[model samples]
Target: MSTFQAPKGTYDLIPPHSATYLAVRDAIAAPVRRAGYGYVETPGFENVELFARGVGESTDIVTKEMYAFETKGGDRLALRPEGTASVLRAALQAGLHKGGNLPVKLWYSGSYYRYERPQKGRYRHFSQVGAEAIGAEDPALDAELVILAHDAYRSLGLRGFRILLNSLGDAKCRPVYRAALQEFLRGLDLDEDTRHRIDVNPLRVLDDKRPAVRSQLADAPLFRDHLCEDCRAYHAQVRELLTAAGIAFEDDPTLVRGLDYYTRTTFEFVHDGLGSQSAVGGGGRYDGLSEMIGGPALPSVGWALGVDRTVLALEAEGITLELPASTDVYAVPLGEEARQVLFAQVTELRRAGVATDLAYGGKGLKNAMKSANRSGARLALVAGERDLAEGLVQLKDLTSGEQRPVALDALVDEVRKALD
Candidate 1:
């Protein structure tokens, strides 16, 4: 028989490596929870049109990257390529934004699938920790989302990250900018696909990395220059709020987010140390997303941080997170009677909130002690038949290798005190 491994571009997080993934997740979620954002979970897949309309039909994600398929019942579905669209769909479906609260604050952490040509830091499937503040259109809300993302990155001890901010302009001014940008793009001697992109989403033309296109784009129309009065005022307030909160950012006119739904304020967190796959995570104001998906005119702003890319960025910076110990106490029992007695004792320890684990199989004392050390346990509880007969259990401080006998009744308390 042959054994098949995890599919290419997909990874199985196991053992000590899985520990890092969990640590990263907890670190990112801690600040979000403290910010009064409740956790929300949606289905892994939704109707294909949900993304095609919500994420924008013109963006590469909906057109190329999505893992979409037809169901046996003939319904078209797609594994969510990102979290925000699904989250918004659920919030709208549940009527969370029906004037109950101004902004329905939500934070979610989960896996997202994107069928791309997998490369370093880019995969077929990945996980993300995203947050959305829907139902509000205030500029301070945009600043708050940026602050939350910055806090998440700082909490992970990450440096070398630059927050790039831009305004994609609202419906009031974006149409004018789009026409001017398309006219310039049409005059260039571009490939058929590049020309097609101009008709689909001219702003994505700025996102192209090709040297020739970039050289020609230097003369492209700037969005900041064409912003209408309302968009200009909104952009000014968002910058002011960010300044008041001591969050540093760079205003790049060329920073066009990939998705079509994004409008007005757009931002991205980029890490220079991660090589070409430098975009750790980013998001922006999707003011028209609700209406685009056949819902009411609900405007919102949010961001999604890539957990996998953030981890790689941390690694690239040589930052190591000190993972908590897996076991607080390793209870090793010798002989059958002591095993049964210690099993009961460990249960009590666990009830007292002490992390305790015991040897699964009957290994020798030497082998068992080795397991204790490997678990990163601070204390090892040793119980033998002779010690049990005397109503005593031995406690060995793994760090000091000092062994002492304690009364069975005092075992839990003694271990707790020793740990402290």
Candidate 2:
């Protein structure tokens, strides 16, 4: 027989460590909730074509990184490698866009999967806090999404992070820019794989992370150069609004998003702390994804922040989150009768919103006290034969090492006040 373990790419968030994870999640998602973005959850996996069409077949996620399997019923599904496609699919299926809400604001937090070479800040399974605003094309919406992500990072006590912004030019102008980039890339000294990218998605060639490839494409034609009057105007307006709102960003000429659906505004959050894997999260506007994935034309924009990467960034910056202790009281019972009565009292204390726990095994007084200490509880409630006979329970303050006898009828009140 062998001991079981969690899957290689997954992890079990346990004990005091899990408290920090939760705190990070809450801090990141608090603003989205406050801004009236209702919570929405989609399936962990969806039909494979949903991502294939929406994320682009040439991208790494749909071609190699996706975890796809066929069900017994002959449906091909894949664990979501990202959040936006699944969210958009759900919104379309539910007819949320058809009801004329104009812009349906939603926020979600959950795990996303990708089959990547595991390393620090890059896991096969990870978590993200994402938000989407569907059915609108206003640059203000783009600004709003960017600001929300900026606020989340700032709220988490993060410093030395830069927000990079770019406009990929919209439908009317992107095709022209693509043709110019393709022509320039074709004349370069490149490999067959890099050349193939020109035919499939020339814009992504600008996103190449390889040193050699980046060096070659440094002089590549700029998308901003070929932007039509309308697109150029829209991009200008988005920049103007961000400036007015005091959101600073750099205009990177070659900033092409990894996804195929993105159009117009694209952004990324980068931290200086992490050495190699520095991108904390990113997203952009996908104006035509709805129509591309068998739904009515819906223009939407959103972003997803990697919770794991953010935590690593926090660690890198020495920002320690002091999570509160798990327990306020530990009930230690000596005899069988005392255990039963103490169990009932523990239930009552919990029902009244107090964090309480109890010793499970029949342990000696010293051992029970040890368990109380290990629980991080500030106080302990002990009920023994002698104390019960006297119609009282012994209360011990673990911090002060002081003990007092409290009447049984007033135990809950006494404990509550002392805790306060």
Candidate 1: lDDT over CA atoms? 0.91
What C-alpha lDDT do the candidate models reach, one value each?
0.91, 0.89
Best by lDDT: 1
Question: In model 1, which regions exceed 4 Å deviation?
Answer: none
Each candidate's root-mean-square deviation in Å?
1.2, 1.7
What does candidate 1's lDDT look like per residue over 1-420, in tens digits?
A: 449887878888898888988998898888878888989999999999999988888788898889999989999999999988899999899999885787889999999999888899999999999999888889988998999889888988997899999999988899999999999899998999889999988988899888988889888889999999999999999999999999999999999978888999999999999898999999999989989887788889888889899989999999999987889999999999999999999999999999999987998899999999999999998988889989999999999999999999999899989999
Each prediction's TM-score against the native? 0.98, 0.96
Clashing pairs in 2: none
Most accurate candidate by TM-score: 1
